[model samples]
Target: MTSPYRVLRSDREDPTVLRRELRRRTFPNPGLAERVRAILQRVETKGDQALVELTAELDRIALTPSELCRTEAPEPPAAPVRKTLRWSLGNVRRFARASRPRDWRMRNREGAWVGERFLPLDRIGVYVPGGTAPLISTAIMTIPFAREAGVREIVAVSPPPIHPVLYYALRIAGATEVYAVGGAQAVAALAYGTESIRPVDKIFGPGNAYVVEAKRQLFGLVAIDLLPGPSEVAVVADEGARAEFVAADLLAQAEHGSSSRILLLTPSAKMLEMVLSRIEEEIETLPRRSMVESVLRDNALFVLTRSLEEALDLVGEFAPEHLSLAVRHPRSAAKRVRHCGAIYLGDYSAVAAGDFLAGPSHTLPTGGSARAFDGLRMDHFFHRTSLVEYTRSAIARVEPKIALFAEIEGLAAHGRSASVRVAGRGRHKENGPFLRGRPPSAKVR
Candidate 1:
């Protein structure tokens, strides 16, 4: 059960060594901007008709808005639903209803009552990925957040892996309009305001490399939640940790794609061995054995450390999307964790628990974004602005000081303005208390 990447020295701290051990680029694709821009232009020129033609040519789904927008569609959870797209439009409605917000106001230190005013974006387009698989949860996680934020006129666009049953989910999720489109073009339709669709102020949700690239390129032109990257997980396990739990977690991330990476850090040689054996044994019977193997070969790393402290140090450096602490006292280990999108504590609470049913947001920072970012929450949908007010007496009290500071900066006009308010007359600029209103060349007695 010994891991192939065990470190003999637990306390080794050479700067170069640490860098080499943990260094990796979670985002590497390039040239996505040019590609996405081209597609956005095409969609803008063609409109709704363009979107239909693109759907048929790129995804093999011939769809019209009437066909794609529906309250309910067929159900093909793990299999093809045939002819029409299969989705749960009602579920989208449920999520939207659950996400609405309440008005808020407050009194500030200045005593002038201030509050925020909330309004919905004029229009928004939903991006549903239907290429490799149908993503019902994607609708739940993303569209609901927008709906809760009071976004109006939400539309949807996606390419059907088969036909176009998936659009039904968009309708259910509070989408007023829907389109059968996918890839960069879908992003384009949302960004550039194609004849069929209006350009939006922002774009949301995660997608493939091409889609992610499009988002990145258009960041300045439009707002985005966060950049999507390869899936990643890091497991911190103690001697008592279960090998089955550790192996299953690695496999779950592995199934994301060949690019996805998983890491295991443990203080127990015996535990590491058990996990390795379990991984090898389970892969043969895995539903996606080929994917598991390919991921392990391309981006996997298994580390055996001398103690839990060393494991903790390495885990923080990676800042994985999902982190599971399977130690004797999982809570104790969690206190040391400074970085991780989500943490699954204890053997009973595995990564899978947080993936689906956990009340916390599943959309989290990936790559090394955990270093400065947090998982998506209701706050992500809101923006903050400050209100400040000062009394006229307050200005009078500080005018003398303000005048002196302005004179020091050689802004004669600024000092005049500062005193002008104090005088309540023409040119109410404050006289410099330090200079007693004398010119710099004039003597102060």
Candidate 2:
């Protein structure tokens, strides 16, 4: 019988062909993009009506504008579940606080007061995936960062029939408003506000292809977090690594959905065989066995490398969202991987830990986007503005350089704008070049 997953051997296959197979398509399907474009256009033009119609058509759940924003709060989960959620929220909050950017000022060589100030967006939206899974962890992973950043209004949206646990998580994570909407329509409503839902300054969280495409289409209309779509994991394990642990991690990611990508890179053929066997045994026990099986058969790949180093090199090419280093000296091996969204070191460090309980936000770039984008962070909720204040003396010092640049760029007004401040104006004791005492004409010109 043929194996469920395709196996590529470095000794047998061409490296270029293997790499081509490993590389994920960076662009969305044109057909998918067109469909998402229609949804976005509908939402942009029709507002709440489009949202209601699309929600019914796509999600198969009818909703009215009045029912879009859920008014009543959901009862908290059971004690044990609530305790676990609190534990996870606490870790996420601490991480957000610790990782938040700080405002700082420093004098440049010309002694200009230059710095950056980060301010939280006044309002933002968080999209939680409610299909296949409630994704309660998504709320904890996304919203606390905005709350910790001091965002005043946090809007959370999920599909209809939102799970009680997920609703509870969203409220606990600091969403001021909750909406019963999902898919591209929810993203469109977030980007282009409806009658009830006001537009957010930025949007966060992850979703399926339609949602990711919607974010991509609406990027300039509203600030967007990185494109974190689907789930992906690449495990690099050696003969010394536990096959059970490696197989479990692969299956865990596969359980996310059929679109999820799973990869196993091993130098030892015996290790590869063992992991495949373990996956077959373990997958039978999973409740989402069909989904996991579909991912394993279609989206999974097993690569046999000449060495662990070769496997690591392939990992860089793949740029997986989550990387597991299940090998001897996992930490040292992790140091060599530069492109993955997140890394789990050692056999005991399951990717599920990072997905659910880990302090870091699991809203990470997917579909090879890890090559360019980073996982969502607390700072993503804040907008950064560069602060520049140049004194008359500082302006004088840089005027010649500015004049030269203006001359090169053929913008005489640009040079004059700088030179006018220093050229014959009386030296004032004010801190900035343009101050309250400056004439309106001087300030304008």
Candidate 3:
């Protein structure tokens, strides 16, 4: 059988070819985009009827409009599982509360009171992928942030056969409602709303290609967190890094699915060889062995770089969803990285920590989107509105500048709006033209 991973030596390969190999295209290839577009349009036109049809056809689960929303309570999880969920929820809640944005007021250059107030979104939908696994932790990672942000309504949706543990976690995380629908249809229902399900102001969480594409297509109609589709991890290892630890992290992400992207960039060829050997040995132990193997065979890359710096440069170009720096000075190495959804430093800092127990939400930008987008955070749940208050004196001071701008733009009414306020100031108002409802001079010039 052919080796699962392909290796490239930077010293031997052409730079142009290496660059082309590292670049990943954004999600929803043309065909996927068209399909997602049709799903969205179907939902928009047919509403609940489309949801039932799509859920039955795609998810293979039959549901009535009423069954779409899960109202009955889920069975409690085992004691050990419940304890773990509570512990994780506590950590996520504390982190979200501490990191949430604060309202502030300050004086501007013109002495006007200007600041921003952060308000929680009225309602939001969190999509938890219920594919091969339950993804129990996604609830803790996503919903509590919205809860801590004070969002009034937090709706959660997962595929049918919703895992009991997942449903319990969503409730503990403060989800106001739970739905049993999934896929592009779930996203469309959340975005456009069905007869049974109301639309939310913003949508959160991550999922498969269809879920991400649905978010992309419905962006203007509803707010979306980010295009956090498949999982991705790039590990930059040095000679000092442990081979077993490096290999374990790579395999951990590979189990996410075949679409996951995994890269191992190392300066030490010996380290590379050891990790490859270790991966082969560990692959046999995982229950999801075939899934991991598929990812390793098609999506994994092992690059031998000239130096650790070169490897870091390659990581920036890749802009992986998860970055692991297993080097002598991982902290220092992390300083040079420009793009990546999240960075895990040192051999001991496993990406799984960030994925499951770590306070940071695992819903991160994937497919090279880290260049522009950030991982999910508490602040994403808030709507920031700028607060501006101008005193009479402050408006008077800036009136001339406003008039100049209006005159330059030929917006006479724009200047008059501001000028009228200043014009009315200090006037005994009974007969003042500014107060008599007369229009201000048409020409500010």
Tens digit of lDDT per residue, candidate 1, span 262-323?
88888887887888888888889888888889888767877767689988988888888889
TM-score of 1: 0.77
Q: Weakest 10 consecutive residues, lDDT, candidate 2? A: 436-445
Q: What is the C-alpha lDDT of each candidate?
A: 0.68, 0.89, 0.89
Over 327-415, each residue of candidate 2 has an lDDT whose tens digit, in order, gives 99988898788888999988899898998888999999888888888999878888899878888887889899999999999999999
Query: Cα RMSD (Å) per model?
Result: 9.1, 4.8, 6.2
How close to the true structure is residue 375 of candidate 3, measured as C-alpha lDDT?
A: 92
Deviation in angstroms for 232 in model 1? 1.2
**C-alpha TM-scores of all predictions:** 0.77, 0.94, 0.93
Q: List, residue by residue over 24-103, the lDDT tens digit for candidate 3.
A: 76746899989999998999899999989998899888988888888887788999999988988888888898899977
Candidate number with greatest TM-score = 2
Superposed by TM-score, candidate 3 places the C-alpha of residue 275 at a distance from the truth, in angstroms, of 0.3
Which residue segments of model 2 deviate by more than 4 Å? 430-445
Clashes of each: 22, 0, 0
* Range of the 10 consecutive residues with the lowest summed lDDT in candidate 1: 435-444
